[model samples]
Target chain A: MNEMIENLLSHRSIRKFKSKRLNQQQIETIVCSAQHASTSSYMMAYSIIGVTDDSKKERLAEITGQSYVKHNGHFLIFCADLNRVTIKATNDEYENMLDNLENSEHFLVSAIDAALAAQNAAIAAESMGLGICYIGSIRNNIAAVDELFHLPKHVIPLFGMAIGYPAHHPESKPRLPIDAVYFENGYQDHEDALDRFDEKIGNYYAKRSENNRKDTWTDQMKRRFQKTIRMDVTNHVKNKGFNKK
Target chain B: MNEMIENLLSHRSIRKFKSKRLNQQQIETIVCSAQHASTSSYMMAYSIIGVTDDSKKERLAEITGQSYVKHNGHFLIFCADLNRVTIKATNDEYENMLDNLENSEHFLVSAIDAALAAQNAAIAAESMGLGICYIGSIRNNIAAVDELFHLPKHVIPLFGMAIGYPAHHPESKPRLPIDAVYFENGYQDHEDALDRFDEKIGNYYAKRSENNRKDTWTDQMKRRFQKTIRMDVTNHVKNKGFNKK
Candidate 1:
């Protein structure tokens, strides 16, 4: 594998971090790299917030149910923000912006834009020898997160990422067989595909050190699905300024 | 700007592509890079379908409403797939994999994972001197897309992308101002941020050649938002066997 592919293939999420701080130039480089990502129609309907405050980090850690949130060297939140565009289009000239982002397409565009940029930033960071972990639990309490971020209408926090130099290398997680995913012309729906996948996952999980937990991937997945604690996101997202309609 | 950042900053969608075929090793390298992206819980709940067959490309082109789809050197469809994990979890010692994916978190995770990987693939493609354009209109006819790919339940096409040697270099699109986003400490609302952004966008649009009918960013956004063409996705995605309940 080439350097990039090798770096990418040996990828693993890093949670623990060293105490060193990244210089502003490094952050700027990553941010610029992020800004270089493809935006839907150049709308650039996404924004990122770098979280560095101790209290804020603590609170975010508490909210995400992941205790490591506080100690990470960098915390950045990516938001699907059409608020700027919506209001801009509506305010002057010929169109209303808020009315423009009410559909599933724009929403998808915003999220995809955010995601694309985040990936670039993550790669850029990794190239610089930093480790990172994506924190999806930021959305566990949408309204609260919105409040914490002072997010305006038409913008929602998609997720937060914690980044830093790794104190220790975390084990690389296993992935499903590429055949299980890459279809030739279209998606193949063999009813037994998932069953076969589970066996592989079960073996993968079992091989992990016991410190990681003995639960099969399915067990964790089942537990996650059995509850509906964060189900209000649709309504909360709508209330926060995105019109799902 | 650094070369990567310059490439990123100068990114423009390339719809027209020269008929240059990507080698198998190139495809594998790009995917290996994609697989390096971060995944929530290391689940990696996503897939990419590489379409090179002429008839299949023609059909996908017809479905996405983008004529360039058929001509691109590479055509890829990225999907948010939860069925793989769900099926595995259910078939073995468990019977609730499908149920696990029913929750919003699992759905979001899959989508994010897919987007991250796709972005990596895009970057990899660009690094190799290829141009790319994302096809969000695939959602316009989700059922058709699903059927075309033989997608099973819990797998939804998020977006499609066409990559090839560029026939033309479209002008870079404008982005919203940093002030409109990038809140410090807590999220702060800014007044008139939208007006300023609109002016920037309007100026950018005005600078484009007059013959380009879709000149205004706001206008394009309005066209996207006001149209009801894409609303079928909510039900279409549901029909693919994902229980969003």
Candidate 2:
């Protein structure tokens, strides 16, 4: 395989990081690469917040319950932003601004746009020999996060990313078998494939280097789904003026 | 910048493609790279449908209103899938399957997972000297697209991708100014930066080889937001058994 493909295949979330900071050039290049990611209809309905203050990072670390948030070289929050367009419309005296932004389709567009940009940023950071981890736990308290970032209406923080020089290199996690994830022409039943994968994952969890346990994939999933997680996100999005319809 | 970063910054959508089909090995490697993308809580809440039948491609092209779908080497639909998890829970006799899969948080997770995987697949294809275009227009008639793929409930088709050797390479579209998209510590008003960028975009559009026009970024956005596009996706996702809470 080529270098790029190899780099992509070897990706793992980095939790521990060196104390050194990324230079200005690296940060600029990474953000530029993110900007280059394709957007739906070129709407570019996303914004990124770079948190560099030590106190702010510590607060974010507390919010996310991830100590690594404070220790990373850099922390950035990717937001699904319809506010930019709203502002533009108001300034230009365009009608239907609120109606357009309140629909579920626009909300989905912004969410997908933020994700595509963040993935590009992740890949770029990895290619530059930087380790990165996505912190979805930031959504554990969405309102507090929005307040912390001074986010306005029509702008919701989707996720955060931590980037730095790696201090730890964990083994890659096992994935579902190809047949289970990729179907031909139409969706197909993959119960047998999933059953076999459960055994493989069970072995993987039992044999991992750290935090090892004896549990299958289904076991973990069952425990996770026992109760709802982040149930307030829907209400929060609505309060933020999205999905009103 | 490194080769990988340069490749990322140089990305442009390929609308025209050579009629050559990808070898099985190349397709496998691309999908493998996609599988390596990070998933929220390891839910792996996504699936891919590879459509190679000519008649099916033609139908998809009609659904998307993009003729390039028929000319690409390959086409794949990325799906936000909660069905697999629900099925596993049912088979394993776990409770709360419907409750877990019907929430907004899980729906967002599945959408983000699908986008992350699709971006990785795009980069992998580009690294192999292939071209790709993400077809969000597939959402224009999502119900039809789902029917064409015979998708089950809890599985929503998110977007389609067309990949092939490049028959045409368009210039990269301009993005918003860095200050406008990236903020420090907290969100900031970037009206000035956006105003400056409007001029840059106006020039870009006027000088482009094809579809030349004299319109600023704000102009385009104003026209776009004048009416809602794809207003049916909300109901479609509900029909697919997501966001029911």
Candidate 3:
């Protein structure tokens, strides 16, 4: 693989990090790269908040239940923000604009915008030899996060990123088989595809260098989705004036 | 900027391709990079459909109303798919699993997964000198695209990407001011941030080599949101068993 592709493929979520801050230049580069991502209709409907204050980071750490939130070299929250666009549009007389802003499609657009930007930041950070982890746990308490960030309506804090020098190098987690995730011309059923992958991942969990355990991917997934996690996000997002049909 | 950061920042949506299909190795590299992106809870809730059939591409082009969709070097539909996970989780007795899959948070998760994957693919493709453009207009008639792709439920077609050797390199479109998108510790407003960017983008639109026009970013956004475009996506996504609280 080429160097860039190699960098993309070598991604791992680093939970532990050495005590080194990502300097201003590095953080700026990350945000700059994020800003350049392809936005839907040039809406640019996302914002990156780089949290540097110790108290705020500590509060975020408590909210996410991940100490790395406070201790990471850098903690950045990616919010799907359309409030900026509303400000620019400057015409409240246009009811369609207001309604459209609340459309689920815009919701999709903004969230995708954040994700695309974040992945660029992730790749950019990694290319510079920094380790990173996506803190989706931030969504576990989205309302509190919004309160912490003072997020405006139509600006949902989607997720956070924790970046730093690696204190540990965990083996790359296995993904679903190529056929299972890739199809040609049409989507295919994965009813049979998981058996081999389950075994492969079971082996991975059993023999990996750290935190080795014996569990199949399916079992983990079953344990995961067996409960309705983050169901409150629906009402929270709606209360934020998004996904209103 | 480092080479990769330079690559990330220099991204432009390439609408015209040289009619060169991405080679197998390049395609594999792109897909590999996508698969390696961080997924929420290892759910890997996404799929990529590579449409190689000319007729299928033509149909998708029709659905998207973008002729470039059919003429690209390679066409990829990045889908927010949880159908595979449902198959793997396999126990019909698990009501919560079924409920969780339909949760709006899962909708967010799957879509973010797809976006993260696509961004990696975009970076990988660009690094290899291939160009790409995101085709979110596929959601214009998502039901038709779903019909064409034979997608299962919970496999929403999030967006399409057209990849190829560039026939033309468009100048990078200007983004919002850094202060507008990046904040310190909290979400911020763009009330004043747009004035400078409006001038910058207005200049870009007036002076650009291709499709030059006279307009500011504010005007474009106002024109964009004034019409409630793709409003059917909400019901379509609901029909596809997503965003169900």
Tens digits of per-residue lDDT, candidate 1, B1-245, equal 44545555666778889988888878877777787788876677898998878888888778877898898888899999876655534454344545445554556667789999998888788877889888877877778888887887788888888988999877766655555656657666655665666677677666776344324555566555543557666556555544355
The true-versus-predicted C-alpha distance at residue A186 of model 1, in Å, is: 1.8
Candidate 2 per-residue lDDT over residues A1-245, each given as its tens digit: 99999999999999999999998888888899999888989989999999998888888888889999999888889999988876667644544777777777888888999999999999999998999999998899999999998999999999999999999989999999999999989999998998999999988988999999888877677778777788888889889988777
Worst 10 residues of 2 chain B by lDDT: B86-95
Q: What is the TM-score of chain B in candidate 3?
A: 0.96
Candidate 2 error regions (>4 Å): A91-95, B91-95
lDDT tens digits by residue: candidate 3, B166-227:
98867788777788889998876666888888888888888988789999887877888888
Clashing residue pairs found in predicted model 1 = A86-A97, A90-A96, A90-A97, A149-B187, A154-A241, A186-B149, A187-B149, A194-B88
Model 1, position B37, has a per-residue lDDT of: 83
Q: Give the TM-score, chain B only, in order for the candidates.
A: 0.91, 0.97, 0.96
Candidate 1 vs candidate 2: which has greater lDDT? 2
Q: What is each predicted model's overall lDDT from 0 to 1?
A: 0.73, 0.89, 0.87
| List of chain A TM-scores, every candidate | 0.91, 0.97, 0.96
TM-score for candidate 1, please give it: 0.87
